[model samples]
Target: MDFNMIAARGLVLLGCGKMGSAMLGGWLRQGLAPGAVWVLDPHPSDWLVAQGVHLNADLPARPAVVLIAVKPQMMGAALPTLAAMGGGDTLFITVAAGTTIATYERILGAATPVVRAMPNTPAAIGKGITAICGNAAAGAGDLDTAEGLLAVLGQVVRLEGEHQMDAVTALSGSGPGYVFHLIEALAAAGQAEGLPADMAMTLAKATVAGAGALAEVADEPPAKLRENVTSPGGTTQAGLKVLMDPDTGFAPLLRRAVKAAADRGRELGQ
Candidate 1:
């Protein structure tokens, strides 16, 4: 797909909150012009206003890509406004959780290309993983278009099917909270082991960050990397014994949490 084509076609970002602003920043960081983006927000930001980007309360034009970043609950109100703008050729890329492609088809018509994506809060820092899926109407170029738009924020992977979107939502979408809790747990453990509170927190944060970076860039499997660090009767092994216990450790808790999130996502789609 020619990603260069999307920039030439123009784009509209509906809603400009934290995630929206982050996506905009990522695009600008990747060299997309501020003029190529038309923003629609009820409350415009001072910085966005100063960038020469349009910030109207209503739809201004029919764009090649109409990114839906508003809260899912606002879909009913927003859809009509977008439809009125005549987004016939627009590829609808919705970041709102559980808003299925069927909903977009119902509101915008079946011919419109719709892509559903799950992007985590990490995208705010340009280190996110986005899962993308699209409908039958999406052509080869449409997938490229959606992927290119999402790639502006972070890594993009196309899901096998839209059903997997719920799982993606459960994993990467809600995964940041789980990682945050793990960092907190590690910090508390450090404090218990006699480290100063401030130092413990600093260590935990850096350790988590470094570990994540290693996992991302490493060619070895995570288990192998983990085993390489664990020595016979070492302190790390002793801690791992508790964390890796099958009946009561991290796995069961994380599995339950992901299931709960997936179930809630399914419910939200209905």
Candidate 2:
């Protein structure tokens, strides 16, 4: 999407940490006006200051958008300063997890247009996916604007309702941790089979990375890909027998794990 309009209008970012910096870098790369952006953070990065962004300065009388990239815990401190900006034409988008759209409305105003987003760890490297939901006050244009801004980070998926965000948080928000653990487990298993420690780790990391890249470009489903790799009685098939067990396989384990994460997200919302 053309970002010329977004670049022209002023934008205020509430944080300038890793994820926020990654997002800002992408926007600048995509033609956002450096002079039109303002960043607010207690500890501003040298890189951010070098990029020509207004750092810790008095905000514009009214920015076109206010993006909250602070931690969920820092919401109290960062949001109070911008509460007045809400309930107006200026849209508010947040990447803070476990903070619902209702909470922002309560702090800002019932009519505030708030968009809550959940982005994963991969966002730090521009490989993540984000799920977003806007409050009742948000319209098609508002959501479109939010998506355009977030598309810089990675793939963007819009949710049907705010409630679905919990499922999204469970799946992708915490998914990187699960994938990292899988890498560790694979390395440990390889070590048990007598592969050297460093070699096992290298193999585990490369295997997972390669597989994910393949899946991203593959034309067929994962099941089809798996079948193509498994010979009549090969090592891949032997591993599949253990991993595909209906009762004890990855399905049941991942189901419980994701449910727990979703439940925790709901609890945090309260």
Candidate 3:
């Protein structure tokens, strides 16, 4: 939350899409000066233009930080623009999935302090959790700076090493999509059991949301929470019987899913 260094030295943002806009909004709300921020985007949104930031203009010779939020496909073209700012004290933080620290070091210089982060879609609402890892050029203070900025979106965690990033990408990065699909499937099952379509969807959404909130605040682990909810001979137990089956349950299925996603992440990084 300390804006002393960044406010004086300035910060440059490479892309201003949904995730970028969300972070920019949080920063501005948390007292970061508008004049200290510069945004570069091919198609600037009306809201972005109204934010009073230096849009598509010249960048500061040495910014405190440069956040790269462009998609992976757009990164090749978008990154070179800031190559001039590399190989110095300026820190670069990237949220683009599948882009590795080595790639940035290759484009920028190896001396560039690059921090790679993976944040999910929930960041749009300030509820996402991001995992970050920095290259050798980034010092302890640099990691602290990156974590401080990223905390505006939600919780920020540090990886032991870059190798763990692929698993993190599989678990939390893509987990939101799996949760969304569960809502859809739950609603369909409710409809199959004779509930009205609208009512089924409403119930499904509320149940998932409520459970997640409970899990967040509860002291007990998730397994204990599940045990607390289901009585021995109740309908919940009957449902759990099918869902907990070792061969064909959520456990094995999700393992395969996460493995597939992690494998793909490794491939993309390569």
Scored by lDDT, model 1 comes in at: 0.84
- The window of 10 residues in a row where model 1 has the poorest summed lDDT is 53-62
lDDT by residue (34-103, candidate 2, tens digit) is: 8889899999878988999888899986788899999889999888899888778889999998888888
Clashing pairs in 2: none
lDDT (Cα, tens digit) per residue for candidate 3, span 1-270: 899999999999999999999999999999999999999999999999999999999999999999999989999899888999999999999999999999999989999999999998898999999999999999999999999999988999999989999999999999999999999999999999999999999999999999998999999999999999999999999999999999999999999999999999999888
Which segments of model 1 are wrong by more than 4 Å?
Answer: 1-4, 7-9, 57-61, 85-87
TM-score: the better of candidates 1 and 3:
3
- In candidate 1 the C-alpha lDDT for residue 141 amounts to 80
Runs off by more than 4 Å, candidate 2: none
For model 1, residues 1-270, the per-residue Cα lDDT tens digits are: 343555677788988888899888767777778777888887888877886766774444567888999998888888887775443777888898778888888878888888888999988887898999888888888888788877767899998889898899899999999999989999998999999999999999999999999999999989999999999899889988998999898898899999999999898878
Quote each prediction's TM-score: 0.93, 0.97, 0.99
TM-score of 2: 0.97
